[model samples]
Target: MAARHSRKLLRPLLYTSAAAAAGAGVLYISYRPRNIPGLEAPAVPPPGYREGKLVPPSFPSIKSRLEQIQDLKRSNDEEEYDLLIIGGGATGAGIALDAATRGLKVAVVERDDFSSGTSSKSTKLVHGGVRYLEKAVWELDYNQ
Candidate 1:
């Protein structure tokens, strides 16, 4: 009877150990750094970021909303943007960044605050659309 009781406890312990091992394996797989193609070198820390903490940069006096709007208008009238993004959400912001990085003048105009639109309601998963994949297969379009 004692042996059977011990066996029951051992079975649960064995199951718990297996679960812990599985969880650890998943964590290792998820967090393990892999070498990316174009990012061979280590990333440089952003400005105002130092030693595991962010050192906020000193800025000029904060402008009022009206002043900011006037400044934006002046800049918009003076400079021509190669790409003008309608939204300031994730997709628009990403496009603007890419364009600016490629030496293009990019302007993003948002009606609401950045990411206040559809970008805010994200699952946080980077995934390709299955519909697009299906379409690609059907049309034999490798670029899709």
Candidate 2:
């Protein structure tokens, strides 16, 4: 008699638990950050790291400031140029190329060599955030 009553309660409890689990799975898949007003754009490559087949970033120890940047006029034989580029990083390089192509005299200066700053320290993969693998691992463990 007691066993029969226990079974009756168990059936409904199991059904409720299964429904809740299914609902959670559905929510996890469908939900993602949509339009959060005033939220800043995510980082180019996120903080952690990544592994791939590409030339890794290299850094110098104590940069004693390049002469070209410190004394622009001294480095240059000409008085002035049409465009004076600030850094020799990727963006700056692109700017210089564009200006030069347009028949404008251009000069680019960098405290260090090309991409020597943070840009130089990139891990090859262009369109990915750094913590991608970590996120994947987390998602795998995080059962909805």
Candidate 3:
């Protein structure tokens, strides 16, 4: 008898919860920003918008870039690289950048896109480091 009464109570509670959820969803959809007036994407081209080229031509053209890749591949097979970094994440990219700055012929090859691992994922907090620092200061822990 008590189980039956409990279930009867649960059914109404579930229905009301579901109705509230649906109403919240409708509210969110109706009240959300369409666009900020000034921030709306320009209909006509904005200043300095190029027609044909996206970036400046002083940067290597597509053909030159392809040729450079071919040449690099050929040379890499024949000649040993000064620094051959395997990944494209923070550590690998940093090492490659450091080596290149030091006048080394650095090559970084990754199975996935750049920063596809740790760098892409969220730490899931704002001011996390600052909070940590505040806690450490409060606790008087220097090692942290």
Candidate 4:
């Protein structure tokens, strides 16, 4: 009976030791220091960091709608715009802003107020519906 009890205790101890060794091996392999390309700390600090301090970028002041419209008219009379975006909805406004930031002359023409169209009616949910995907596939609508 004593020998049988010791065998049972020894079996558990052996298993526990094996598990601990495996865990340690995994931890060491994962945490080992090694030089990895693109993972190294940048020699030069990124933009906006000066002398170990973060400096926020200065942005131009927001222009009122009237001012923007006047500017648009002035630009239209002076020179042709590189891009003319119709509608000031989320997508259109975003594209306009992106183009303008890239040094392109962009003008956005909205029927009504900005975001008053379909953008304002959005439920703000970002999800891919299986039913919509099925419909798109069945109808051969690649745009969807």
| Candidate 1 lDDT by residue in tens digits, 1-144 | 999999999999999999999999999999987854445432443358679888865555766656756766787555866887897777777667667666687767778876676744553322345457777999999999
How many clashing pairs per prediction, in order? 0, 1, 0, 0
Off by over 4 Å in 1: 1-68, 76-78, 119-144
| lDDT on C-alpha atoms for all candidate structures | 0.71, 0.66, 0.70, 0.75
TM-score on alpha carbons, each prediction: 0.40, 0.31, 0.35, 0.38
User: What root-mean-square deviation over C-alphas does model 3 reach?
Assistant: 20.7
Q: Clashing pairs in model 1?
A: none
Tens-digit lDDT track for model 2 on 5-94?
Answer: 999999999999999999999998789656554365432333444575454444435434565446655645566688988877767776
lDDT, residue 29, candidate 4: 100
Q: Give each prediction's root-mean-square deviation over alpha carbons.
A: 15.7, 17.9, 20.7, 14.5
Least accurate stretch of 10 residues (summed lDDT) in model 1? 119-128
- Give the TM-score (vs. native) of candidate 2: 0.31
- TM match of model 3 to true structure: 0.35
Better of 2 and 4 by TM-score: 4
lDDT of 4 at 42: 48
Q: Which parts of model 3 are misplaced by more than 4 Å?
A: 1-72, 76-79, 120-144
Question: Among these predicted structures, which one has the highest TM-score?
Answer: 1
**Any idea what lDDT model 4 has?**
0.75
Rank the candidate models, highest lDDT first: 4, 1, 3, 2
State the displacement of the C-alpha of residue 92, model 1, in Å, after optimal TM-score superposition: 0.7
